[model samples]
Target: MGSTASDEDYFQRGNLFWFTVITLSFGYYTWVVFWPQSIPYQSLGPLGPFTQYLVDHHHTFLHSGYWIAWLIHVGESLYAMVLCKSKGITDSRAQLLWFLQTFLFGIASLSILMAYRPKRQKRT
Candidate 1:
């Protein structure tokens, strides 16, 4: 018996998705890290509502955005790990930069897990 899945029916395994996620992070970090001098800050122009709010509220916005983005990255990393398990895929770094990404994400995940532990309690 021969069976094939259509493009729509086909989906990537967990490892592939996690790998891709890490790869993208590696590339992003490399771009900003190695090319710090070459990278110019993109100007958002005159202070708009967001900038105005940040101004009115002070520098808290900057810290908030920074931390929020970091939290999001951490969440995505965890999601990738879960996805990898769900898809039964072995994740690996295709490039050296991926190593950095994995390490960084791993640290963040560990820190979060250490700070918060959730356990399922059996209903007696």
Candidate 2:
């Protein structure tokens, strides 16, 4: 059996630690922006004060940040799709997965795709 271009261009998943941390951070931001009243600020410890302050004094800031963050994620996801195509990741499933992961995890996912260096083929 021999290697194929698909094998060389397969997308790699990002690090578990980074993926988890980024997911949690995004979740927190979502909660803070959409359900600020439900957040137990004191329980957040150091982040509590900042979170409360933002919600109290600058809610628009939080709202803008949330939307902008998602917009950036959308842009990054599109770029990841392009990167997949350029790197010869021809599988539609792989490209869709890349887009979704990058949409959710942003740079955590895109960084992995960016780091990919397709294997060079031999000039037989």
Candidate 3:
């Protein structure tokens, strides 16, 4: 049997959640990196000045966290490529686009993937 309308709606909602998450994450990181001073922290928040924050946090767990995030982005790119292949998406340009977008935007790209994914062929 094929997916019902409710199933499609459920998937859309899930995709929207993921897209929102990715957008917020990117916005937060951009703010933290480029505009930390404007964060309206009552006191110096977890990290102080951006430059000093990097210097002081180097070799600490926070440093590791940055590397971990980088690794996750790499993994996401790989996952996007694999997902396109598994879904039988044969266009090289589309595959490349998804891979790059997933690497840069993470779950935002996943939302796009979900929305545009090929419908499964029903077996007789």
Q: Which candidate is the best by lDDT?
A: 2
What local distance difference test score does each model get? 0.41, 0.83, 0.58
Kindly list the per-residue Cα lDDT of model 3 for residues 32-121, writing each as its tens digit.
555655765435475446545654454355446656876888888798776666655546766776777777667667656655545662
Candidate 1 Cα deviation (angstroms), residue 2 = 23
Candidate number with the higher lDDT (1 or 3)? 3
Clashing pairs in 3: none
Each model's TM-score, in the order given? 0.35, 0.87, 0.52
Model 1: per-residue lDDT, tens digit, 31-50?
Answer: 44345334334443452444
Write one digit per residue (lDDT tens) for candidate 2, span 5-24.
Answer: 54433767778999889889
The backbone clash count of each candidate, in order, is: 0, 0, 0
Q: Positional deviation of 45 in candidate 3, in angstroms? A: 8.5
Off by over 4 Å in 3: 1-59, 114-116, 120-124
Return the lDDT, model 3, position 25: 70
Instruction: Judging by lDDT, tell me the better candidate of 2 and 3.
Output: 2
TM-score of 3: 0.52
